[model samples]
Target chain A: MERILRIFFNNGSFFTFVGLQLLCLYLIINYNSNQAAIAAETWSIRSGKFKSALTTVNGYLDLREQNEIHRREIARLRSLLPESGYNITTEIDSIQDDSLLQRFNFLTTRIVNRSPYNPNNTLVIDRGARFSVQPGQGVMNESGLIGIVDRTTDRHARVLSILHQSTRISAGLANRGYGTLRWNGLDPRRMTLIDLPDYVPVAEGDTVYTTGFSNIFPTGQVIGTVEKTERQPGAGSLNLTVLLSNDPLRATHGYVVQDLFKEELGSLNEN
Target chain B: MRGNDAISNALRFLLILFLQVFLFRQVSLGLGGKEYLFIYLVPVFTALLPLRTPRPLVVLFSFLLGISVDLFYETLGVHAAAATFVGYARQFALGLLEPRDGYKAKSSPEGKDLGNRWWMQYLLLMVGGYCVFFFSMEAFSPVYWRDIVVKSLFTIPVSWLFCIILVTFLRPRI
Candidate 1:
């Protein structure tokens, strides 16, 4: 080590000579225009090759996350298929037509928790008040209506599931008189249509839809297909246990529907 | 002792630099690329530094003088590099041409002390080498190899005579 140091430095004086010469040359290269351009061009070529090699390594490490984002994207795009074309109008920002003026503006979110078997099932959703998800706004998945927003925090909201004991939506046979849609405590897929007359001509496989009486859901939104009907013991009314299209346990993503004209309609109802 | 030597050396350096930049630098004559002569007189300063100076100090001082000339001429680093090489090589040249009696400690190389023939021989060897190195650097690149040689050949005689006059007149004494 000592011999090497002595030879390298010539006991330090040689070291000083070399160091000062290098510094002067470096200053000359930096201050002179031709030398600066040559240095810059050589530096860029070397650095670009180094960076691309690093990027190849980095790109492989990030592929798992990229795949997951792609999966979510596919799910969001599938919601746009022809069967659910009306659902595309949910974008409030893109509402350029008068037909969309009174429509609910929908913002999609995921269900984080659920009590599907409970007599009054409540759902937890990922969005909250900060996302403009207010109480009374309806929630739906690709298949059909899921619930209504009951309350919210900045990051999450609780939804009152349609299967809840107090849940009611104005629904009826297509082009028929309207009644209430509700669920019994027994089954998740079956919801009942209440207060249709016993002599009503509705049958199995008949489609029930929202009647527009409740400002919460738009008219013609599918509630269910009729599974069975039975006459009430004394009221001479027909009730149904229609199979709901959206099974709460199976559906993971849903949208909170904002009623743009809710305040105006509420004031008119109060008078 | 070091302080006195440094001050005297610094003064000589300034005088040589002024003469080179203001006097000999403007003496380029000839217009059509025939019989052209460009003299460089400042290198005599490097040749006549005190005989006892350390090799490294001589090289360093010569480089500084070269850089000072470069700043004025705007050639930049060409003269400085040439001077440094000459200064470093001077000890080898002296070893080759040393007298049979050897050199005195504090004496300068002069026509009177070293004999007029020895002085003239010293000037021809050192100043001739300086002109070749300087012009080669000025016309850098192997493509201009002939130009550098021609310029140096023409420049040396004129530059050498002028440098001899300057050396005899100054007679630099500590």
Candidate 2:
């Protein structure tokens, strides 16, 4: 022990030098932009690998609840079948509408990780780049919007939860003008809708839906219902409190929405 | 004499911090829309410490100075990483550049105590190394090797000139 102590003191500078360099490496990876990107990519892939085993265990624990959700979803999808609709114009020959184009495609995947408490929380889904899951695509379930895809690896993708502070969904009253929907980073069950004109009628229990202006989601998708409304004196707009329909913490499955015409629409905005 | 040396070193640290944060930081030299040069004088603080200063103290001081400048740069750890490397390597560099008669027992590495030629060579090695390491950390990958090389090449001579000017203006007596 004495000899070891002597050696340590003798080369203290060497040890400190190595130690400090390591600290600097850590800081560089965490804070610097280029290094941070590389670090984020590595961390997502590694964490996904480690979390998969735990996710398997959790999946078994939630099997019963998941089956119930699956049943509801199947029934809902079945209701959209043409056979379920009655043709009132049986006398006239049926003609398919050529003017309408299918623009949105949905890919289903399981949510493998949940982080609802963070100021900017994120979720990890089992689908990734190989599954055509790109960043900026929206993720939703039967309830409402879960989040937008933030980053992706080969087999998994990280989603920016609606509970995150940066989340701003373009939403509006089901019958009135639109506004921006935002999370206040304080409540998981509620969000704030701003920029809606005070002239527009807003009241408790009014449903809010995505305006489809951004092309990330289809028009008329349910976001939530207004729980509270406040208009400051002399303010031109009303601030609304919305109770979210989707609880991201309870979500196990999500459909990643890909807008087929997104690039075609986005290119015009760039010009 | 030792007390005076300590006070002067402290004052030098403050001066460099001021110049770095307020003055040099605002001056940007870019070419073709890419920022190719930055005036970095903070590394000189560690490079010119007294010849006999402990290596650990040198490394710690470099880390502090780099982090202080980083606060202004809003690039938290980039400068700190480069400065720490320079500080740790300073001893090896000094050993390489030692004169036939050797350094004075109680003198800082300044142009007056050391010959201008010797000081210039030392400044070139230290500041040049700083610029290369800094840009490398900023780029953070060999994929940006061209950018790193371009930035370091444009920045080295200018940074070296600033270090020389600083050493001359603040001629530490100790």
Candidate 3:
């Protein structure tokens, strides 16, 4: 027993090291869905509070620029709707008109942090679950489509920015009819719209917008312009380069497009 | 003397944690690759504590440092596991370096006491072990084998170099 104690004391560090390894292994193995849900809940509350405070602190610094943006947006919206005949009460009602309201209806949010460098670049917004923000909600700045909300806490949500390699948005050329916007993970300002047929007449600088095939983003929201087009032999598809309209680095604010029928659409699809 | 030592160690740990959380967390290296680096050498505080420091105290402090970092970084339990491993290995590191006469009284393993040559050796071994353990644990699967190895190899030298520079510059004379 004395000899055993001596040996144990002699190699105390090794024993502790082994013990920690086992503990880590236990944690990894036991990492469950329930635990993750609880963690998500906790993080939601904590991050929500933190984000709210941060926004409040930084509010003064951003007020002038944000005001200018709001003014421009108001002016743009006003030019489409006359002052006398347009009913302000129908702001929510107008969303039902898929054809008429395609150019308008945006939810404003502030970008707290963003990473364009990451392969899976993500953006954090000041709005979250408490503010009706949810996963799959589409986000856009004044210029164009920004991203889709991937995760949401109570007061903060993470956006899978369009710059991310994993992002694939349904897009259509203004002149042509079909394409899908995809990132090759090379440049934040550029993405590729692939699989368009060679017969499609895609001119340089032609506008591209969301197709609204998915319920996440509304139809006709501007994405970018066709920069370059290439027709590879025997491929049967035109590879088009697109320069994104929104400068993700400079975009401090955006709006989340919450589709009111999202839940209904999801339930219908599930059945 | 002991009280002063405790105060100095606490201050050091706090400083390192502050730098890691505020400044180093934002640094990224690779453009489109999986490589990333952060200033994790703050946990080296627990590792560099005097060899005669109580084992339980060292472990507890290391655990606290790790958990604190994890809370800020959104990576739960990972930093705790790595920091604890470092704390555990610290004694072995001291044992390997100490002469037959044992560690000098009131001497910490900073560059002043350990000297440049021994300090470099000690920092490299500890930092290298930490990088391997941290990257492997983070990857946690054979699929990311290449990623884990490359990331660990790339980050260890940079992290160790930063750690050594900081220790040499800020370490008080014995």
Candidate 4:
């Protein structure tokens, strides 16, 4: 018994090492989606608070540019709205009835923290669950679709940027018809639009927009412009290369579009 | 002896964590390749710590360093796994360099200490091991075989180059 005890103690370090490895392996294997969501939310909130405090010190420098951009956006939205006989109560009812349009309503926020360095890059926005921002909401800059909300906390949300490998948006050719917008993780400026029918008249410089198939994004939001197209022989689809509308590196502010019907849509699908 | 060493080691770990999370993370090699070179060097810092340490202590530090990096990199437990692997292999790396008994106190493992020729071998072994573990855990499936190969090949050398430079410049004073 004493000899056996000595042998066990001699190799005790190795056993401990193996035990730790097993623990880590378990962590890796049992890494739940819910845990990831929670972690993402916590990270977003913490980073957002830190970045917001940091950016506030520097925000004054960009005030002129930001004000001009805001004015231009308000003007654009005004132009889109019906000019005559529009009442506030009726508009509110209309917004409620059309969940997609309601879902398109945005909470403007500064990008407190951002990472363009990752294959599945995420951005932190200074707004969150308390502000009604939720996961799977669409995020966009003034130019176009930026990403989708992945997680949210009380004071911030993390957006899985379009630059991420996991980002897949239902997009279609403005000139042609339907396709899936996917990032190849090769070029930040360009993305690939696949599953496009070969017969679609895909011209160079043609615009691409969201199809609104998903509850996340509104229909007709611009995504990018087709830079090149190739018809693969025997394949029914065309390979299209698109230059993304927004330069991720330069974007500082964005809006998170809350998908009001997401719960309803989810429940309906389950039934 | 153990307690003082533990405190200093903890301090060093915190310093490296701050550097990775706040400063080096912002430095990205763009063009959609999706690579962060400077941040990968954080593990090498832990791996290059003095070899007189207990094996369990080394592994513990490696796990701590890796998990801290994972927190910032948003990669979950991948960096933790790779860093621990490198920590385990550090003894073998030293064996391939100088004789185990001939090692000096407070000297960092680097190209100079291990000699330049053997240093390349050491760096390749450690960095290659790190990259393989990192990319494999990240890819996590055989379906992304092409992507895994391409990403690993692109990132490994860049990470190794960063590790070499950092070790050379930050070699501990004898």
Candidate 5:
């Protein structure tokens, strides 16, 4: 106790200096409105930034889990697609009582490889027969239609891109007229919508969509926009130059649509 | 003689404290809205304390005087904290500005005891330290560092000038 007293006496000024400054800080932070407000604001701002940084770190840490949750969410949304349901309202037809059956299921797939510049461009998708990705299933991305699935192994599938020369899409303009969408080998970004009647009042920038004439593609999926309209020398049909919306090379992910009634539709067509 | 010195020091403290809190506090040199310069004479008392005075006594005296001024300005601890720091820093400033022949016995730091050059340097240190520490404590953070720096720059020279004049007048004719 005597030694402690001697220490205090020797450095009394230093101790008092520290003690007084601490007391002043306490008073400033407690009594002064401006200082108190600044302390509170600084604390809240620091805590807010800390929380955001924590959330970002947590998000990065659980990326695989988050990806799985997002994939399930996409699957759930795909199940509710209008094209995936078949209307069963027959002789007793009422708006509220119409029954429907599930007809299509969309399986998400990542494009592993694509050859957009090839005359017969094809895309390789990750999911194949093991994931129930069958031939003739339609593939599309959020931007626009992609292509039809051509063949599948147990683990992967090949897709025939819309940029292929032989690929013909039954496209229409606002249900006013119907035409076939065909790509010329020269340009991947441009396609010709042929067989549309001139009386349909086609104009530039009109949107062309799939007409669902076949079981290949869903109804009203956007194909492209009309660039120009041309008339053959003696033909009554109008050829519309369409600027394709989907650039196949830029597409990294797509959905392969499995139509449940595809075999039945094929058998009926065969009959 | 020691009794007379104590009385004179007490009188000097009261006079500098009153002038700082009342007269100099109201003085503003700028045109309008915001004052560009501030005058602080209280730290001069701390600066001019007798060299023989203990560090703790100087600190305590400065704190009391600062809190007295803080009561008038309604800034409870800002002035007190800055004054305490200046009081603590006084030893360092005096040591740095020590005369070649050393300080005279029983003499305080004033233009009359120390040369005018030493007096000017000492006042500059004390006033500059007071302004910077006071503004920093008032702001309570370095986020307003620009305000602290600009105010200190504008206040130091002006407050130093006023302190010089005041200390010169208050200097004893021993």
Candidate 6:
């Protein structure tokens, strides 16, 4: 502090010297437009950077609110689907209502725990009876389908991850052919699709989707992409190694998808 | 700082102030165009301040003198600020040309008592400083730096000539 004083007033009466200079500066700033503009610009740049820094520092504090907003957005989009009218060949009357539907609803949850090394890798999700979550509902995130709910407690549910060896989900291709998607239990990133004929026009890079044949997941939902194909010469069947869209082992958030028409669909299938 | 010096210096101050504002300040040099020039003489009063006057007192007196002139010229504070600058610089100005006797035996600075050479040097420093500062502040912008220089150069000699004529003729009883 004493050094600072010395710098301002090296002479005996530096107080008067400094005070007059400060008064001149104040007057200049008030009366000078060009100088005032420069000053204002400097302040704006400095303050803007400071405000952004402060926001980044507090970003972690708003994570829960941000997550809640994203969850609500996904739920809203879930109940609405594209209309068939977008197709030129389909009749306008055949188009279903594209407005919000009660047929599909979602409740978002977090993955509390999960395992990949086990033969039946199951996920413990952070929603159960308290969130109206039930067994057999398909679970997914924005990237694509992950699993089906297997059991529930008051506040949590256990899901059978698609990585399980016993899992067999009917899959669809862009050409409308059928295949079975199953995890081989060795490489966690690879899922095997089988029972489609080689004449099905299958390609290595073609996308595979859920067929909605079992009424578990919505029709046209993404399953994975074809990675490689194997031909059984005698059986005339093609086996495909599919690459899952997003690694479920690394996923943190989830949504339980409920199908409102599941009972009707099940009864129809039984008949 | 003394009785005699105060009386004599006050008389010189009033005399120079009157002649400057009433007579010299009104003179105009023009070329019949939109251009003209001002003749400055009030600085002579500041230039003739007693050599041994205390630095602080000199600054204060010069400030008061400049401000009083500003009242009539209506360019308030410009004159005062310029005068104060000259007042503060007087010590250093004299330092550039110190005497063997070291500023002793001098009641007032004049061409008669001090040699014409010493007096002219002193006059140049005081008037030159006052004019540069006054015109720079009057212009109020650095873009007119050349303008300030030209005005100071023209003002210095004319003001300097008028001061000699006053000190020699009017002889304010110092």
Residue A28 error, candidate 6, Å? 10
Clashing pairs in 2: none
Model 2 regions more than 4 Å off: A42-271, B1-4, B172-174
Evaluated on chain B only, what is the TM-score of candidate 5? 0.91
- The window of 10 residues in a row where model 1 chain B has the poorest summed lDDT is B1-10
Docking class of 2: acceptable
Candidate 1 local lDDT, residue A10: 54
Clashes of 3: 1
Cα lDDT computed for each candidate against the true fold: 0.76, 0.85, 0.76, 0.74, 0.83, 0.74
State the displacement of the C-alpha of residue B3, model 5, in Å, after optimal TM-score superposition: 7.8
DockQ of 1: 0.06
| Fnat, 2 decimals, each candidate | 0.00, 0.52, 0.20, 0.22, 0.58, 0.00
Candidate number achieving the greatest DockQ relative to the actual structure: 5
Model 1, A165-255: lDDT tens digits are 8899888887576678887777888999999877778879999888767778766888789999888899978888889877865678887
Say which prediction, candidate 2 or candidate 4, comes out ahead on lDDT: 2
Per-residue CA lDDT of model 6 for A64-149, tens digit only, reads 89889887876667455444225433456655543334677778789999874676798999999887777878898877778889
lDDT of 3 by residue, A89-157 (tens): 567666644444334345789999987477678899999998888899988877888889999999999
Q: Point out the worst 10-residue segment of candidate 3 chain A by lDDT.
A: A96-105
Docking class of 5: acceptable
Q: Best candidate, TM-score-wise?
A: 5
lDDT of 1 at B38: 83
Please name the candidate that would achieve the greatest lDDT relative to the true structure: 2
Q: After superposition, how far is residue B147 of candidate 4 from its true place, in Å?
A: 61
Q: In terms of docking quality, how is candidate 1 classified?
A: incorrect
Interface RMSD for each of the candidates: 3.7, 1.3, 4.7, 4.3, 1.0, 4.6
In order of listing, the candidates' clash counts read 0, 0, 1, 0, 0, 0
Tens-place lDDT per residue, model 4, A1-271, is: 9999987676544555566666665566557354355456667889999999889978897889979979999888767654532446566656554332434467788899988486777899999999899888888877887889899999999988888898888899766488888888888899999889998888899999888787778788888899999887888988889898888756888888877767887887784
